[model samples]
Target: MTEEGDQEEQTILTWARNYAKKHHWVLNPDEKKLGIVIRGLARNKQKYGEQYCPCRLRSGDKEKDAAIICPCIYHEEEVEKDGSCHCRLYFRKDALSE
Candidate 1:
């Protein structure tokens, strides 16, 4: 990745970490893997005008697809039930101990 891309990834990762911290959640601790997900988010933002989850297939319906945007509608529920978001990007800190 170019320096620009690396910078963008770092920015996004910082934002994600701050967001998780604000909500008492935690980002996946694997820096290499997190970078991949953060890059995917940046790519989605460039392509679709939103940071849709990279793990999900877009429906091509912008309105419907909005639900899958970063911090997606399903994430809270997924994290509550599964202990982590569907992409495993954000998870409960307690889950890390298990």
Candidate 2:
């Protein structure tokens, strides 16, 4: 949500650089939006589900390591991140129950 020349944009870059340090994953190509983005292949199911994991290193919390608080990332507070246009973000219980 920052304009090109705005200082807030610069601040966002600082945040982005920190996000990049999280892992070795490179920025994905479909990434034309504002922040850092990563991409990978994922399976889908009819019912969409989302969750936020502890990997998101928000400012100030002692447990820095990743935790399995939630299984999927939602786009609102989170949303199912896009892998490719063809893939839907969900898991079928019958298929997932394995």
Candidate 3:
């Protein structure tokens, strides 16, 4: 990755960490998984102009696709029920055990 890409990934990682801290959540504990998700987010932001969830496909409609952006509309419910969001980026504390 170029320096620009590295910077972007770091920015996204910082944002994700702050966001998780605010909600009493944490990034996935596995460093490999966390890096993959963060890098995916940075790539999407650079290529698509939005940090769309790396785990989901875009529908090509900005309005419809907005729902899939990072910290997507489904994240809250997914965390509550599944212990983590679909992308496995945000995890409930207890979920880390499993």
TM-scores for all candidates: the values are 0.92, 0.26, 0.97
Q: List the residue pairs that clash in candidate 1.
A: none
CA RMSD of each candidate after superposition: 1.2, 13.9, 0.7
Q: Any idea what lDDT model 1 has?
A: 0.89
lDDT at 75, model 2? 19
lDDT of 1 by residue, 31-92 (tens): 78787889999888877878899989999999999999998999989988888998889989
Q: Rank the candidates by lDDT, best first.
A: 3, 1, 2
lDDT of 2 at 68: 22
Taking the tens digit of each residue's C-alpha lDDT, what string does model 3 give over 2-98?
8999999999999999999999999998999999999999999999999999999999999999999999999999998999999999999989887
lDDT of each: 0.89, 0.27, 0.95
Scored by TM-score, the top model is: 3
Displacement of the residue 28 alpha carbon in candidate 2, Å: 4.8
Best by lDDT: 3
2 versus 3: better TM-score goes to: 3
Candidate 2: Cα lDDT at 87? 19
* Better-scoring candidate (TM-score), 1 or 2: 1
Residue 43 of model 1 has an lDDT of 84
Model 2 error, position 59 (Å) = 23
